[model samples]
Target chain A: MDAALTLLSFGPDGWGDDIATGVLVTVGLALATLPFGLVLGFFVALMKQSEEPSMRLAGNIYTTIFRGLPELLTLFLIFYGAQLGLQQITALFGEETTIEINAFAAGMVALGIMFSSYASEVFLAAFRVIPRGQYEGAYAVGLSHTRTMRLVILPQLIRVALPGLGNLWLILLKDTALVSVIGLSDILRQTGVAARVTKEPFLFFGLACLLYLVLAVLSSFVFSAIERWAAKSGGTR
Target chain B: MNAVAADLVERPPTPSRRWTGTRIAGTILVALWALAIAGLALYLVQSWNPELFDRYAGRYWSGLIVTLQLVFLSIILGAVLSIPIAWGRMTKRRIPSALAYAYVYFFRGTPLIAQTFLIYYGLGSFRPQLEAVGLWSFFRDAWNCALFAFTLNTAAYQAEILRGALESVGRGQWEGAASLGLSRLHTLRLIIVPQALIVALRPYGNEIILMIKGSAIVAIITVYDLMGETRRAYSRSFDFQTYLYAALIYLAIVETLRNVIEWIERRLTRHLKR
Candidate 1:
């Protein structure tokens, strides 16, 4: 027990600091991904709803391709395939610089793109639920198209999108563990290293499980609170 | 009134003929874009190494078979195990419900990869104890560990889904059964379960799809499933095409399953559509 405690301590002999850093990296990846995902998702949703058939088709294909592929396969394709594609493009431009994508950036882009595919569906559903009268009402008030969206549609969209987005967030949080396969020093990867170095897989992996559970539980509470707040605010509006 | 009447008179009688130049252009552009995509796909297929396929075809086939096996066995076993857990959650007893909740919470909260590692490597530390109990052989193999983890994880999800579906069966159904002098078990077996299963079908399909995606993680633990074989081929060739091929195969499987599930859903709910 003492040995185990010492190994988990923050001293030079222990990997406590490493594990802490891993947790931070995982959280940072998720935070960075959230906005990218939401913005792209909103854009895709708009494209799907566009007046132009081509735009709708494009959006449909994008969502179908991304959503159909496994998240891990998407990561690998982006991480390795992106480099090759970039190198080819640079060669065409007569440049010699080799572009490298760090695991974090690759993870962010892959996860963000995948998240957007799912989120677009959620946003599209939310958009569909808005009464047609609301748009007509906005027009009757002499609001511009953009102004109508901002004043009349966006708030309600967010309220309806919140729960689905929250569920996606939980999924995204768990998916960050997959980044470890690409050598990101996230919680799972760090635990893997500690386990290998200390030759105590049970101790380290079990601890990693506990850490993940703590994050999951805490995030669930946070989401529930935000949902309640969204409901209340939406009611007032 | 004159301007409104003029506008109405000028409009085309047929909607199809009302397609302006811009609309025609949009249609043309969409067609051109689709052609470009088709051409790109054709180029990739032509460029693919046929010799490589011939050499690794057997390996890929076996990998695909293993992946299907893992997904099928785990989903079936997990679904079976979920019934008791779902029952525990639904019961009035506090302790059982809490225990079931804890099981679901822990499994759902963590990543499957973490759970896989904990079972595969973590249990290696307990080989001596397992051997003492004559279970070391079961824990020693990576395949068994992967199967075990997948089963446990899916059971938690399936349990929650089943519980929700069962509860969604209206209380009136239970009351009607009781008033008819049917016992609780008989009611559940004869009527409630069938209805609950129909309600649960879609979610069950979703869970299976998720497990199919998640079974990829078992590759990390040295199970030479589809993803594992893909990785192996990639390492051998150092070509990204291997990954694309694997992705294409996965996409086919997912698309097929999606269609199958939709068909089943339609068949099950055919009565409601009327």
Candidate 2:
């Protein structure tokens, strides 16, 4: 027990600092991706709802592909292909500048795209959960489409979408570990380094699992609270 | 709207989307999609390499087999293991229930990759003891570790599904079975399980697909699954399309499985269809 404590201790001789930094990185990565994913998901959900069949088809194709592919595959695609894509675009301008996508950015983009695909489904369902009356009621009052959505629909939509998006956030929190594979200094990576150096693989990896579980359990609590808060106002009223 | 939702008074009115139909939104979406689609086509044309495709075809096939094998074996084994766990979860007994809950919570709470690494690397620390117990060889292989982790992970999920499905069967079924003088076990096996299984079918399909997508993590540990093969090909050839091919293959499998599951659902629930 003492040895374990010393190994996980807070000072220079211990890896506590490194692991703490990793936890920060992991949490930051997830937080940064949240808005990107939410916005992209909202956009795609709108795309699926568009008047044009092509727009709808594009939405369907995007969701199907991103949601179906493994997050790691998407990460690899973004990591390797994004650079080439930038180079290609630059070539068109005859400048040929190369843009390298770091693992953190790649993970962020891949997970954001994947999260959006799933989120769009939740948002779509949330929209559907709002009764036709809400739209009719808003229009009956001569509200513009944008106003109807903003003032009347979105508040309720967020309520319906909250639970689903909350679930996605927990998943995103966990999936952040995947970026460690591409060389990001996330929780798993830090623990992994300590595990190798200390030759105490079980202890370090178990710690990694514990940290993730703690995050998930905490998020579950936070989400339920938010759900309760959101539901304080009546959906029907 | 589905007739059932419409007919079912307690269910909410079929939810309707509040869409952004402003012409500006539509124009922006069109422009963005067009650029995306056009760029994809250009990239495909510019980077098509026939020779690399021919060279890596065999590797991808073999890797796919490994992936399929890993997912199927673990899923089957996990299904078998989940029976008792599910039963424990449903039982009135305290110790068994707590243990089962803990098992599910831990497995479900953590990431698959972390779980995978723990099994793969963590077990090696017990090499001496495992060798003494004559289990070193089994724990040593990356493939076995992946399989073990996947099985443990999927079993918890399957247990939840089983418990939920079994509970979804109405209280009347139990009363009907009891009045018929059937034993509890007999009633569950003969009547309740069948109905519950039909309810469980869709979740089972979803679990299998998740397992397929997740099995890619094993490649990180050098198990040479489909994703593993892609990484190897990428290292050797440095072709971005290798990852694209794997992505498409994965997509094809998921799409195919989804349709198959839907078809099976239709067939199995044919009697209930209106």
Candidate 3:
């Protein structure tokens, strides 16, 4: 136990800096993916909510493909496939450009796509809850359909959607570790490096788990607080 | 939250032939979606390599089997373990409940890869002690270690699902069953469980789908699951088709299971709808 303490102690002598950076990268990756994912999801939900059959079909197919495919596979595809596509595009310029795509960007894009697929479902449900009366009422008051959705419906839909989206955030936080496989120096990979160097896999991996647990616990507290506020706003049950 | 689930019962809205501006945007979106599909098709055709199918077909098949076996066994085993854990979580005993909560909290809070490495590489560091206890061989096998980690990880999730489902059952049913002179076991089996099963069905389906997707991680540790096989094939041929095919296979499995579960839910709840 004493030896464990010495090895893990903060400073250049230990792995404190590496692990700290890993935590930041993991959280950063998740945050970067959130708004873009949420917006994509909102559009997909709009597609589903639209009266056109083709639009609804488009939404259904998007969710089915992304949600069903493994997250790891999706990441691998984007990481490698994007590189290939980029290489081809550069070839058109008559110059050899070896582009090693950023692992962080690949992870963000892949996870954002997946997040959107799931978020669309939540958005669909939230959008569905707004009574048809609200739309008709808005139209009766001379509001355009676009303005009604933008100003009236979407605002109320957010409160109902908060809890579900919060759960997805937790899932996304845990999923950030998958980026490590593509050589992103995330928390898991940093701990893994520490384990290999010190021959203390148990110690470092245990620390990684504890770090993730703390993040998850903290997020849940924040989400529950938000949920309570949403409830007090009198939208969702 | 149930709000996250897609509503299968959503009625088709009444047809309106009005060419609203929103409808034009919808049409444009659908056209763009079709164009994307066409681009993907073009890419697939352009990248076609029939040689990959001839060489790694068997390896891919075997890897898929391993993935199926691992998830199937872990889910079944996890379900068994969950019964006691869920009961513990729901029980009046403070110690057992707290212990159960801690177990679930730890597993749910941490990433699966972290848990997997802890069991695989972490336990490897304890070989001498494991050998002393005669469990070294089991821990040494990557398949066994993956199974153990997955079982434990999934047990926590399954337990939470069970506890939530059971708790969602109304208190009036239990009192009514006791008044009917039914034993505690009978009340659960006859009066409460069937009702809870319906509520649990979708989440249970979600868990199974998640496990199927997550089982891909065991591949990174060299257990040669589908994702592992894809990695190997990709390394050998430097082709993206390998991962694409594996993705298709997984998508097929998830979609089939989803439809199956939805069908079962409908069939089981046919009596309750009226």
Candidate 4:
């Protein structure tokens, strides 16, 4: 029975294909959501820095609502609510079609939103850590605000932000499991389905943990390499 | 508008230059969000079928009670258990410290879902041996098994947080206490642990919020917590809106807990001048 659970056999027979598919999806979801999160986080961080009463207020509200809400709740809210809203919008066009949002997209949106809130704080903290002298030096060089940010602030921000970004990546990788609830065929979901079908919950779950352990270990190695590379670049450009 | 008021009271403005586009965008965004929230509230009120609520309210209530009980108990047990784990890590020993590190690394490395499954299902594999050892009775109940998993997992993370807090107490401070001829235990209990607790309090509060959310994962087991109940409702009714309702309940619980955490952090740290 244990030998039958090997990865290569057909579905409902061996977990090989399922485990492989789950890992790919998990990695895919994590990689896809990361950039979207960074972009959203950048805007939020900028908003957090806004001097205007309203801009700061909006930024604060965005972070507060998302941060206060559980990752699972946000996933459900956007998953169902977004679908319903899309359906309503289609109805206005007289199509009257029920459009379904894919579970992967919904999961990405939810994870992206959550990660953006946290990454914004990381960016904000990085922004604060930039030496005031650098900005003044950029000003002395007659660099415009945008150029100054790109040339001076960003390079330093990335350096200070590397450790945090690494931490965020690890977190996002783990959180990809939340997609299991939305019915995505990720590792956890695959394990769950296998558990239900095979009635061998222990085998599937044990395998799932081993799979995650592999991913976590593999990711730490990647992050450590990045950390070393970042350090070797001599602090800041 | 009211939400803005709530937000502002919690986070006072740090002085910065006001930008016009930022203001316009900010106000529009906030207004849009407020409108969306108000709309959701109205939809819930208008579309709420009292019969449906009455029918499922029992399960929801039962689930809610279970959820709270599970979270509260795991945290209490996790808190008590974490101290020794943390102490073992901090003490100048090789083997115990190594074991402590391994425990934290393994648990923290994996997802809580994996941890719970591994505990409940993985342990169930050794049912005969467990029974022989007289431990199967404790592990047989889904709730007990889930509680044990959560407790161990939380203790690992908490141990790290506590260890960091303890290490942050300056070397001089430890020496100062030692010079006063205080015993090692006295220095730790009276000086080191108290100060560390004060520092650990905020992070620990955050952990509590984390555990509240984490408790939802126990639903995968036969134990019916809030999320489990939500899943059951959705499966039965096939209405995704039931999930939204569940999410809102979760959001409210998290928001209220977050506010409490912030209030406590501020109250505790008030002595440190900003």
List per-candidate RMSD values in Å: 4.2, 6.3, 6.4, 6.4
Cα displacement (Å) at residue B6, model 4? 36
Model 1, position B115: C-alpha lDDT score: 96
lDDT string for model 3 (A1-237, tens) is 878887788866788888999999999999999998999999999888777877888788889989999999999989999998899899999879889999999999999999999999999999887889889999999999789988888878988899899989988999999999999999999999999999999999999999999999889898899878877876434
lDDT of 2 by residue, B167-247 (tens): 999999999999999999999999899999999999999999999999999999999999999999999987787887898
> Which residue runs of candidate 2 sit more than 4 Å off their true CA positions?
A50-52, A91-98, A235-237, B1-46
lDDT of each: 0.90, 0.91, 0.91, 0.85
Which candidate comes out best when scored by DockQ? Answer: 3
How many residue pairs clash (N, CA or C atoms closer than 3 angstroms) in each of the candidate models, in the order given?
0, 2, 0, 1
Say which docking band candidate 4 falls in.
medium
> Candidate 4 on B1-274: residue-level lDDT in tens?
9988887786656877555665778889889878978887888888788877877889988998998999899888988999889988987899988888888888888888788887887787788899999999999899998899999999998999999999989999899999999998999899998778778887888898888888887777878988889878877876666776877777788788878877887887778866
Q: Which pairs of residues collide in candidate 2? A: A128-B15, A128-B16
Candidate 3 CAPRI grade: medium
What is candidate 1's lDDT per residue for A1-237, written digit by digit as tens?
999999999999999999999999999999999999999999889878877777688788888788888888899989998898899899999998888989999999999999999999999999998999999999998999889988899999999898899889988999999999998999999999999999999999999999989988889899999989888887654
Off by over 4 Å in 3: A232-237, B1-20, B38-47
Binned by DockQ into CAPRI classes (incorrect, acceptable, medium, high), candidate 2 is medium
State the fnat of model 3: 0.80
